[model samples]
Target: MLSLCLRRRRSPQSSFATCVLPPFRPLRCETLERRHLLASVSLTPIAADDQFSTDEDSVVLGNVLTSDRLDGSVAPGLTLRVAEWNGQPVGSSPIFLPSGAILTVEEDGDFHYDPRTSADLQGLAGGESAVDTFHYTATPQFSQIYVLGDSLSDQGQLFAATAGTFPPDPPYDQGRFSNGPVWVEQAAPGLGLATTLANNFAVAGAASGTENFNESLLGTDLPGVADELDAYLDAYGPTADPQALYVIWAGTNDFFLPFSDPAPVIANAITNIVSHVGNLQARGAQHVLVMNMPDLGSTPYGLSDPVLSGQLSAISQAFNANLAATLDSSGLAITPIDVYGRLEEITDDPDAFGLTNVTEASFDGTQVVLDPSTSLFWDSVHPTQRGHELIADLVLEHLSDQGTVSIDVSGVTTVPTLDARHESGQAGELELWLSADDASINDRNGPFEYTVDWGDGEVQSVQGTAAGVSLTHSYDALPVVTPEIRVRDQDGDSSVALREVVIWGTVGSDRIRIRPDAGGVHVLTLNGETVASLDPTNVDRVVAFGLEGDDFLSAAGSEIAVEFDGGDGRDVVLGSRADDRLIGGLGSRLLELRGDADLIGSVAASRLR
Candidate 1:
């Protein structure tokens, strides 16, 4: 466990009354749409003023106001009259609540890149708020959740990719599944703990032997992990060394690259990472979870070349085995997940694993070609929004047991599989298969909730416990249509388990439905195809519609964004504040951010609070 403390270094300075409003917005944009949207939103840095007191207790100028007066509830849009310090950038931003005495002045430093700092402004009564500027020392809790690795540690990249907003030459590139309800966040609350994270450090294309990545991945060099830790500690003092430190799904990139054996090479690098992590004990991090590399050979990237793929798989396995042995011997109490095994099931029999078709999901041979409304990939190795959710669910399951703090994460899916066929060019039928490992299947209540969104306007739903190990469903589709299936557990964790079962071959009919009998089990036919025989309490919502031109809409209005499992291939309007509604979706939204804006939609979309 790491111990952190921050000494009060800055003398509080209250400059000329600079009215700080709600809070300043963050500079990072995970989505191109958001980047464009934000581009339209003007930003003006408030200049500083220097005529105020520096007393540690006195209210400062430029400080953010989060009290009742400017707490976002201010209808008709709120405004603030902010003044600057006479001539300095070191003053705070203060606010005047309706109570008269200058309300607390908040330093943006405390809420760095988060929306919570401005939560108090969302529902504030419409009125004028005043603020002063000053600097407040930041003090973090004693716990943190560190996601350390090379560029893979960067959550921004995952966010950008999932949002289809990858920046050119991004400095924040943490492969797919790094953003949103990643394993670290999912596990924190469940374990009755709070975690501060250090995201994807495993840079894309950067491996263990790479000069820039090897040690830098752990922040161990000249401006290395040590310095980074120092900076983080200064900002967030006395916080838990992240509830858990997630080491990369590394090794694959290390071995997959043009390296031979790559075991000892990778193992040595890994040893360095472990050593760095072990040193964190002095800084406070205790629990650590290491994810073994997935079977790259089964992946679209690895499969590109049969020969290369086979070689890589062998090396990957050997490396993982060695790594596991090392971890076991270290007695570091690390939880090593068979990530490769989980992915193997999905890649091997996608039709049986509850996963979207890798072929359909890919784009341009190299990338997982996405159809925006149907496809789930933007490139060869990365995942679309839906892909990220699938991976997130697997990781979160492990996290939930850690017990940081409990959150609703029941609707997610594990390994999903899909099957579809077209009888004629006019219409077709579809079937879906999903894995049932560690599922909360119970005969008493129900195990899962299933929803079907047929491209057009047809929808179907059911709820029940699993009688067997797999869940299945069938759908009839028109010539140009895509179907999406969404499943959720009792805990609210949900996933758009499958997407776009293109039925081009044939089908006798355009529509059909199978209702479960009194016993809760039934085999159904849609357009002459026997699909699902759900046990009564397993379905939730089902709909049918034309898929080709359907767009998904998204609804907003909450602290966190709503999670939309159904991926692209439909129109989505994530609605306005009150009556917001999300339309077409191929899969659940992996991440959503409404920084300073007041959200009025679903909360599932938000990966962070």
Candidate 2:
């Protein structure tokens, strides 16, 4: 993965592919109104820690056949290839280069977009990597595919689309359902799709779209998969093409409650699936791929419990059965991707798919990996990269017979995707970081004139220069909102970057990030007024900032390494949780160091010691 970051490289003619918006984070918004998507802060370039830095290549930064991030439009027939920041090739796939900038994912999964060195689209424009072309009998298969489901279907899209807000960052990092690219990603090229992502609405922990009004808070944070579908339609509407495939895979979470009766769970899950599919069908989705649940009886999690395994298996079967039946009955043009049967087949004969283990989790989150090709499963529930390939092959075969369109993806140059940083605070502040290729950064081509629907009834039109812009806003009263940001350059080009923070937050409460102004000293504010001066040394941005009182609000920047600091209240601090240096603070404190490998500081040690 590229380790590039989004910072201004001082150059007289620097043509970057990213820009930043104003200071804003999470918290309240009003109705679903449109506003310019912008959030950015200039950070000083830091020296690499030697491990990541390598022999660099002269990758030119220019506008190389960029595509529309919103409409998903670019000349279809082109070769695509992307290399890591170190200039090592990831392998050739039939991807349409989307953005002009190259990005690198940090160890902590944070991203840096270096527009200085492009992904080298123009350099490789004449490469001989030919797209594997396929002849289809039906109309053009989906050029733009919209996916809605759970981790099983999620690619790095949730992170890219939602601006790394959803799934938080630490634990559920980098949107892919598996350790690497999921099945949907693996199948993109063969289906005539440029990138594996076309509006991947799938999020980790996504449910089967059967929450009540309060439960499926469409206007609020995350509700469920059905609500996800709703939001996608409301925001993006239907794909211009009728044959666009709307893929839905879910129901793993439905079986989460092992002790509860699994009957209603399965039934409700299928019902939600049916309702969501109907919504898609109504929205002109002609080709729909409905994947049933993989066999719960076979998973490592399921096999962990003998009796409970059987119960979960039964529920999974019932859910799949109902899914198949509903698709059959509703007469929707939905093809069932038999994930359950295919997964069981691989599990039964791991050698057939070149898989080794199917009954256990492999590779700890923050460590090196075991052989993924031979491992049928990445963790207990998700599949490995190889497993995703098998699923993709199965889906392709099904689509070949049932649907239409496959592309010659070789030599197709996939452009870069946009990046943003949006954070909300306790004092009704919205912090955002919006950027795209500097060449395309204008009122015509991006972060220039875009829509930021604050999920409330309010939408604003904000402006910024071509170099990049930043703006901040404070909500008077905390209002329930999911600030949906969509930035479009002059050409209506979208780097396919759109994000709506899915985490719930207090009106103005936020975990402040301490990025000292140049010399590491800045006066902090509550709401918009100055509250205190933050002057600290040796502060790291790795540790997360926690919120204080209702009135104590802090934006993401100008904060510190202290995860929890009760500045002036009767506060309870939890130590030994994350890896952070401890320091004692004001008010009555309760330091709970529940985890090990932690150092307790002075009187701060009084509570835990």
Candidate 3:
């Protein structure tokens, strides 16, 4: 069996010489925050200098974090604690420092911080871990696959009592739909294949390169699908590997939630996944195949949307056309099933395919209706067990003992990691390390790029190669905001990590101003809040906060200044914007509101002075 292979190019910018010298075990310089239980529940004062230690089963719980080795020197007397709330664990309280910030964590287990979720806990473990060191390295010998669109792909559910495993339901029952034979099972024996040809990755209402009906209505369980795929692939071989036969019978939902930009969205997602598969191939298994779109117009969902029926058909045509072109461009050789044509034939005459009474096998003029004993679809969407088998058979027939397939991915650059600070003033920076398992890294092209929003509208960016690098950001104390960080790979693909920062100051009293001009704008900041902004809408009497503290000031068409009451008690001058003066009598009646903005002084009279 000859196989075609295309080794993509590697960027030259990251042309680093491989060096081998010492056996240095990786040390955890930054420990992740972990959740802990409280041994004793109480609202007592736990002083910083105080030490309250407990065992694993103790009622009073605390998260103890040890300082990492800094320049080979460990910080001393650094035991920290994160208290538990109720029965669960909340994040640690701020660990105030004289110079910088420090965080608390659990010392015993593996913890990873997800900038996305904001809370730190046990990171993905076991087979779920993203580490790719244990994959096989032998190239695959086959590429044939059986494509099943959705649950109705197999009609085994029709014989639910006969088949002990398959279930009978509106979505899973093959009895209601006509396409009921296990085509792959029948074809595999004739094809001389060593493994099963069918792959039922299709869930009810699934779409191509996107989520299914259930996943969207519910939610894509984090790391669930990817994690399961990883584990399954870890134990699977290309001879019968699901990867080899990329069967996707989805996109019934795309009609409902069609992509505003379908081509690129679908293309990019496929490329991302296929590139990963190539990475898998580089690790060993070969042979790859993918399925194409089915005829939803024949299904209940397609028929339901009368106005959208034509539109859905057009979208499906366009999507498949682009998909074929994209795969062709990528040098990936996949035999697409003429699902639309087949479905059209089936709908025109269900009897030809052994299906019966599918004329009403449509819903709302858009979705497909299912008829057991003949049709492949289960509902307005999805496939039956027998449908799955037919898809499998088609894939099996394509794998004749011949031809080489090559996929070139050298033009793509690989980014390895990302690092970011939690918030402007918050503790701990996030470091994300991304790796292209089998691809070469390009320093110039970069591992990726990162953009940080420190919750105060401050933005910062860094190239992917800038991993392990640190940058500082600022945040406001009031109007508590969420800190969001985004990382974009060289391919312009991006993911976000979100966190929240607690500001130490208030808003109303902190008088800051942002002056607007024809071109330029003046900004005033107090703590981390921009209490007021200047624009053409409100052209006069702008009230704002100070740059760094709680103080109020008003600006008109003149230079900005602060107001003070004369003949009153001595007013405490916190700070100033410019070289301004302040004078008042000795302590008589001077009051400053805390977290409040209330002024009793005459502004016009004091301004004249």
Candidate 4:
């Protein structure tokens, strides 16, 4: 068979050099600093005696962060991720820093700083170790994504944007409506936009307001959908750009509880939505997305009055119908995410979505203290971070259908290893592993998908796993084979890796040999299925990936030499009786020594930092 291949560029800039490298395990820095107002500050490496200013809100720092490296030499300039919480991203701005430098600024919840790459993220929060990283980049498929709506759209930046009277919910530093990064936050990186550019102008408890104003005249004066547009315009003026997708998700409050609004009020609300879209379209917003509200009558508040809940559900359906009618008739580019259908999917069969307690609100005393990771609804209304992630997955599906996504195979860490020349007419064991143990996308505790190309006409797709999964394929009388593998998460973000193999009807002398380098790798799971997997092999040359679980890995084969990267959490890794190398992750670790020559990455090693 003839080998055919296609390659997508990582960036317009840079050279192409592929080598044996470590897996790309992007970091998930959980910034659970609830109650922080606003503090997007600077990065300045403090003196050895004072790494921090002791101030929680804001700090004074310089642009050029000067600090001594572990090598006793001054560090050089480094590239850092720039992010904003409460606005629309206007352009594809790239920051170029000089080589040979790394920057780190002390930060916590309610703070703002250029997010660091996962490789360089480390800090402390609430006396416990905390970390975060930026994993998204603008690719050819799409540049940026702008959001408009209510709490769901607002990824906590609204609190700091408005400086609302209420302190932000605990553990949510960025003013997100949920406990952690919302669906947009998790989805943006996969869609090729930086996680920081998950810019939003949505406010909590927002609704489709009257014709003139954003907030309902009869209800609280929350920022209206139109008002959200005004905020965007006020910040970045007006422009019509097709590089980014415009997302609008609102209208739950329009038909929410205390559902005693008159007919005229409802009619005006629909008009308000139309006007909002018209303003955006007039400003050159090319791709517009509108998500219909779910069954609000089923919320905690709605449940209090079941009769009203039913009415609210009916009204929500009608509101969604009216909103769709206007968008379809207006003749502008428009798409709708079936949020109404999705919520039903989650509640109708909670087990499928890993959701429990959908009917009742996650309540504890008067406080709305939800883990958000699991609970669907934090309280009466807002979804948990997990809930938001599910919504983002729906959005990602839409992006995928539009063919506007750049896949990052590294995010899933699915690497396939096989000998260069395989005997034709024979089934060769082509081993594949997906190890995204350290890959922490904002809110998703992922279960990703792995699509494998066996260099022939055969293609296979499998769900990722916690401990990892292996795939093998056989070729019969094949001429040449080139294997390519790629991974996609529920949110549709992807990374790709490729390798070529020669198929001979005879035998070969030796196989391929590659050493792992400084690349990130991790595992992402979905619905308890292994989208990202790890394998512990007792082979002569071993490449074992340790994700975020208790793993008992030991190399026992003769002449065993292993390279192991242990992920977060307590782990027990036993080296070969011959010789081995082990790298521990952000967790308590214990190693069993059987090798006379063993290498371990520890606290003193700059490589771990």
In candidate 2, how many Å is residue 69 off? Answer: 31
Could you tell me every candidate's TM-score relative to the true structure?
Answer: 0.35, 0.41, 0.33, 0.41
Give lDDT per model, in order: 0.37, 0.47, 0.35, 0.47
Ranking of candidates on lDDT, top first: 2, 4, 1, 3
Candidate 1 regions with alpha-carbon error over 4 angstroms: 1-143, 150-153, 157-202, 205-249, 256-261, 359-361, 365-378, 401-609
At residue 310, what lDDT does model 1 achieve? 62
Weakest lDDT window of 10 consecutive positions for candidate 3: 131-140
Q: In each prediction, how many residue pairs overlap at the backbone (N, C-alpha, C within less than 3 A)?
A: 205, 85, 95, 41
Candidate 4 lDDT tens digits, 340-390: 778878988887888767765554425645444557876556677788888
Judge candidate 3 against the unseen true structure and give its global Cα lDDT, from 0 to 1. 0.35
Better of 1 and 2 by TM-score: 2
Count backbone overlaps in model 4: 41
Compose the digit string of candidate 2's lDDT tens values, residues 7-117: 222221111122223432321222211111101111111111211221112222221112111112222331222112232222323223233434433211133333224
The CA root-mean-square deviation of candidate 4, after full C-alpha superposition on the true structure, stands at 31.8
In candidate 1, how many Å is residue 358 off? 2.9
User: Regarding lDDT, does 3 or 4 come out ahead?
Assistant: 4
lDDT of 1: 0.37
Off by over 4 Å in 3: 1-171, 174-212, 216-229, 236-264, 348-351, 356-359, 362-371, 384-393, 396-609
